[model samples]
Target: MKDLGLIPEGYKILVTATVQEEDCDGLCWQYIHNEDKIKPEFVVSTEPTDGGIYRGHRGRMEIRVDVKGISCHGSAPERGDNAIYKMADILKDVEALNANGCEDKDAIKGLVKMLDPKFNPNHYEDARFLGRGTCTVSQIFFTSPSRCAVADSCSISIDRRMTAGETWESCLKEIEDLPACKKHGAKVSMYLYDRPAWTGLVYETECYFPTWINRETAGHVQAVADAHKALYGDKRIGSETAMNLRNRPLIDKWTFSTNGVAIQGRYGIPCVGFGPGAESQAHAPNEIIWKQDLVTCAAVYALVPSMYKGKGDEDVCQFRAGGTDTTSDKSAC
Candidate 1:
């Protein structure tokens, strides 16, 4: 759309893409800000949404548990230590932690809200909208001397999701203090991300994505909601579930993470989300988007930059007066 002059002429925009950021556990934007040194007023994330304004999401991190053992020939298993055995016990403890609760008193508060469906909890008083925190074992591996030798080292990867009130240090501490870890002398640590971008720039950071939420009345949020209202007025493909109508309240949260993890979660910058596809379609088989959704989203995208710069009443009146382009031009709608 920007290639076709859809973005307003006076406005400036910067687009970036990341590498090795699969699973939505990303940190490219932070690198761009601190390393590449490109900072903007705010960010607009088009991550898969059910066509609603996504204000916030839970944070996530990658954790590692290392178990060490002595290697011995396979012929005599009793002669050497088997790291896999220790890992098995640690895995069981990890499962218990997921099913049960952690020792941290405050972490339990966030975990319960995330595990139970009755009520979503938030730590931030002004922006009270986020689900619970969670943890799970994602990957495991072990090292052996040879096909006939006993395994000497084993490691497991954890995918920990954080809701309000949870921090990277607290989450790591919770795992380090697990009974099995203490019994086996397992080492717990967070992974460091230092992959080179497609541009060959390597920006290293801890793999901790913080949790954040924004109020509905925030200026960026209001700009997106107002732009949609001015363009479509509750008329679009799909129902309220597929579309966020101007007639309804402008508030919702994504259960999954997005670039917002870096854009707003870490930097405290304001971020708003308005995208075409539904959240379920992401990484799903036969993912598809409605044709009309593209057109509608394009129109709204063009209007947001200009509308954001205008006074509330003046922009609404101008839009209602048809002094804007609905498609790809500077002409009036």
Candidate 2:
């Protein structure tokens, strides 16, 4: 902070490590008070997006599919309706649902990929919803015991995902679109097991991160690009990253939801996410951030404040960084 001497101290700068709520939004809200009492303008998420700073993701939700059918002995399979078989058929719907695209009301679209090899099963084993509400089916159960006997009943739970402003009902409709879903007599409901997170933009939603498309003429991206130029001049490329990653064109959103849920879902604060690591390193065994990249990130984290020559105080907090950026340096105040 001393290095920047950045902003005048009269206002206030409360650095927070945790953007989401360990408590309710109320506690985070309390810190926001301009009166040093309650309510903050917005929050910044330090989660990684390569080196690019991010604003937010779409919201997410839990979805469940339960199937009930009668059971019969192995020899007399025709005697009872097999719940397991019924569910197996509906499972096709789940896959097929992803083969198609979901129309999103928000500008951000299709976050949950049904085709994600991770979500799809190798053998397509059916499952039921555990308490976690993960669309990823954790468990599948069939009543009536013995292997020789047919399943009396069964339930497959799915961890359904949604974008900001999406609901469990809408997600269900997506599933319903599949012909197999209809043929299998699949029934979808939140009560059976579903709870969509609030679509509120309190923080970044896991559903979708509002995309930042950099234009040649530009605004924030251009100014930041210029900041790097001013610091290192034309000889050195700006510290900003271009995500040369092969996966960059593929996806920016995470397959699983992030802590964005707690802040965006529970609280009502606008947020942007930026960090030094890739989505893969997080929560994995060999988590690591490159030293050079980490250093570059540190530089930006330090320099972003001064990069912008704002026309007004309101612009002080607006930060924009890399990805498809195309602008020349034009020194900021």
Candidate 3:
């Protein structure tokens, strides 16, 4: 467009290619926003949206639970406190927390409680739209003096997906309040990321990614939807091989996370998603994207900036999860 003189004179387009997103989602953007001091009026995420205008997605976090015990000879296991046994109790409760219903009669109120107006008063509807939150024990580890002795410690890593009305503090508190966790005095905490980017820059932060949702009628969101309508008609456009999976609503939300976690979820900057490829193809063995999707997305993206009538004050954000109390002040290279 620059060479063809197609860009409007008053409009400026900045393309940022970030790094280390796979290691720690949105950490690069946090650096760009805080260290580089570059904040765009709005951001358009190019994550695979399966040919739809995407406004939001559930965020995620990493949680760790640790339990301590005493080790003794395997022959006399009864003499020692078994960490794995204690962890078994907590693990059962964790499974029930994920599998139980939100009804008052249920022994454990699952994360589905976020979808109930009685529990999530402020954002239950949005929670329903984004779907319920979930928690699963993704990894487990244990340690002992030797294989012949009782385990002295056990730990688990929880993969937590957050819907609207869920926050880092609240999620941690939920685990702390669990009957087994309280009984065994389990230590629950959020994981931290301090890995180096390809550029050798380390931006440390908590693993909490905030959930964000934008109003479907928000200016930035509408701009992409309108642009698609004008360029590709009222439905998703894709190659013959891809059309079968693209038959959903023209406007939707991503089932996966994206850089929008920080752009919109953390800083309140307006963000929307429209990109090539299908969500199912992500990380698949024979991942593929159609050539036709590339052209369609490019044409729509070019027209969106002009169609956007600028931001509005109609509460563009439906819900943005709150941040943690501690802030990382580490300097990046």
Candidate 4:
């Protein structure tokens, strides 16, 4: 495309590979850049998913709830307060929060307004597109004097999946304000991820990854859709028969998080996903990628940068005017 004068002159593409990505806990981008200083204007993650255009995915974070109490011998349980019982109360509220049954659900907290096809109490348009925020108890532990003693301290780890219009701070504050949490004096906080990379460099980062979605009418998505149509010519792949039948646009979102958590979720860089293999194949037995998926993906990736006429940089867009393409001719973008 560049040799054929399709690529603009000032643009350049830099691809990268990383080590310990699987164990980095989403620090692959941070490790590579901190080690080598690789910056970018935007990111396109070709993370494994059955070949399709993914505009965004739900964000996620790690939450820790610490409950404190007094310990006692198992024979004399009445002598001390049980932290595990307090944790059980907090857990009930957490479950009710996920189910949207809390009394203060009318508050501006983002979760209650969730709008899934199966459950939409408020009819929020954004939730209709991105689904709802979610939370669940992922891990639990208690500090006990002995195996037969009452627990003095207990902590539960919560995995929170954030939807649009939600933030890490808000989620934490919401949990802190829960009736059971306040009653139990539970300390709600976001976890910090500080693990050493294979390179032995330890970088500490918060666990909050924000949510993102590219509007279907946005220029970047339009460019990608144009490239897909140009290369694939309206041919459907995989299990897209329903989309084909309904005549809906082929854009999608990942069910699982990707490096897009850092690229777009944290940095606010424009991003979209297209890749080979199914998400089900990710981290599963007998993972595989088809040869044609790679070829098709490469063609689409190469075509997007040229098709993308970004904002505030129109001087480099040298297109053949009055021939076929006629999207824009405005100056001073």
Candidate 5:
């Protein structure tokens, strides 16, 4: 598009995937010039979201819960205590106990989130933000020694999701306060600090995928929606944006993170998520983008270079003539 002069001048545009990796949170900055970075972050990503053109995935974090117990031998069971047996009983007890402290379901919003990879409670983006998915568990497991030495301790890690209205501190508190888990001797503890990955592309790492969420009333989404509506002779078809549906019947975002932390999550760029493959194809066996979806996705991305047509300086993306201002609102832009 640039070689053909399809892209307008006086505008800076950068395109990339959202699969960048990082090991720390000390630095962040993908698009800015080196001398321009005043802050630091860990990573950027470019995972694809099946959501229409504007919606993106949610941010996430992780923690490990270690349950300690005394060990005993299998033979001559009465002589010694069995840590595994205790843990098994505690797990059941944990599963049975209800929310003890916060009884007012009304105080908490939405549904009671059960940890199911199929329908994790944290999957729902907190009602505040639009682009990122809500927090939930992506992985869970326990550690036990081989040969069954009665197992001294146990651990289960939780993959938490973050939404516009949620924070790392709040997440920890929720886990810590689970009445049932605590009764099961479940302590809200972690081997590492609770870390939900930031959703900003403004990290210092080269591995980042900047994210955005343009409203149907704004830039590319509007333009593209307009194009589709014009083609179909109506203004109704798809939601502005949404998560990719997949084998896992959970209401999730892109099931991954992206550099969207900058444009949509930070600096507040009006962004959106639209791409060629279904959420299922991403990171799956024989992952592939359909030729038609590829063509359509290219067409859509091609429009992006010219999507923002307004006034702004070198550091800011210009808003459309009468588009929505997205800086303040995090949940639904």
Candidate 6:
């Protein structure tokens, strides 16, 4: 388009090929925003949206729970305070927290509470639109002197997905308030990322990815939607093999998280999504992207910057989840 002199005047399109998104979602954007200080009027995440215009999706966090115990000979199991056994109790609570309902009388109100007005008074409607949050124990580890000895310490990694109205603090507190966790004096904390990128630069940051949603009528969002309608009609277009699956509303949300977690969720920048490929192929073994989807996305993207009506000072964020007290330190970068 630039070669053909089609790009609009006074508008520059920047394509950022960021790093470390797979290791830590949005970490690269945190660096871009904090270090590079390149704040655009809006961001269009190129994450696969399956031929739809994605406004937002639930965010996620990596949490760690640690429990302490004294190791003793396995032969005298009663003499040792088994950390794994205690973790087992806490695991059951985590399971219940995920499996319970949103009833007032339920012992453990599940994440579905986010979808209810009573529990999520401020953002229940947005929560209902994006879907409820969820938590699950993804990994476990322990330390012991030997296989014949009782474990001295146990830890677990919890994958917590956050919907609207959920914050990192609230998510941690929910686990800290769990009956077994409190009884066992479990430590709940968000994980930190300090690993070096391929460029050998480290950008240290917490692992909390904030949830964000854009109003369906927001200017940037409408720009993408209108471009799609004008270019491919109002319905999602795909190759013959992908048409059956792409037969959903043109406007939708991602089932997974995206860099918008930092671009908009953290900094309140207007963000939208329109990209090639399907969400289902993300981590699957036989991942593939249709050649036609690529061309379709490219043409839509080329038209968006021209179609966007400049935004006003009024906030465009429909709902943005709160971040933790932690801030990214990009000194090394």
The C-alpha RMSD of each candidate to the native structure, in angstroms, is 10.1, 12.1, 3.8, 8.6, 9.3, 3.7
Model 4 root-mean-square deviation: 8.6
* Residue 156, model 3, lDDT: 98
Superposed model 5: Cα runs more than 4 Å off: 17-51, 76-148, 162-164, 184-257, 261-263, 266-270, 311-333
In terms of lDDT, model 3 sits at: 0.87
Model 3 ranges with Cα > 4 A deviation: 325-333
Global lDDT of model 2: 0.44
Taken over the whole model, the C-alpha lDDT of each candidate is 0.68, 0.44, 0.87, 0.68, 0.42, 0.88
For model 1 the local lDDT of residue 316 reads 14
Give lDDT tens digits, candidate 1, residues 1-333.
576775677768766656565733546676676777876766778776666776778778889999999999999999999999998988877776666643455332334544343332323331235655678898999899798999999999999887665567767887888778888899999988777767786777778776667766667777788788898764334544555432334457787888777766665567778777777777889987766667777787777886675333321110000101122111111
lDDT of 4 by residue, 1-333 (tens): 667666778988777665554543346775555566666766677886566677877777889999999999999999999999999998988887787642454332336555533334332455556677888999999999899999999999998887655556667887999888989899999888777766776788777665666656566666777788888865435444223332334677777777766655544456677787667777878876667777878888889888876744322111111101212121111
Which candidate's TM-score is highest?
6
lDDT of 6 by residue, 207-325 (tens): 98988888888899999998898898999998988887788989989989988888988887789999999999999998999999999998998888778888855567787774564
Q: After superposition, how far is residue 154 of candidate 3 from its true place, in Å?
A: 0.5
Q: lDDT of model 6 at residue 296? A: 94
Please, what's the RMSD in Å of model 1?
A: 10.1
lDDT minimum window of 10 residues, candidate 6: 324-333
- Better model by lDDT: candidate 1 vs candidate 2: 1
- Candidate with the larger TM-score of 3 and 6: 6
Error of 2 at 160 (Å): 3.8
Q: lDDT score, residue 215, model 5? A: 34
lDDT of 3 by residue, 1-333 (tens): 576564677878888888878778888889999998989888999999989999999999999999999999999999999999999999999998898998979877999998999998877888898999999999999999998999999999999998887877778988998999999999999999988877787778999888888889999999999999988888987888888888999998988888888888888888999988999999999999888888988888888877888786687877776456423221000
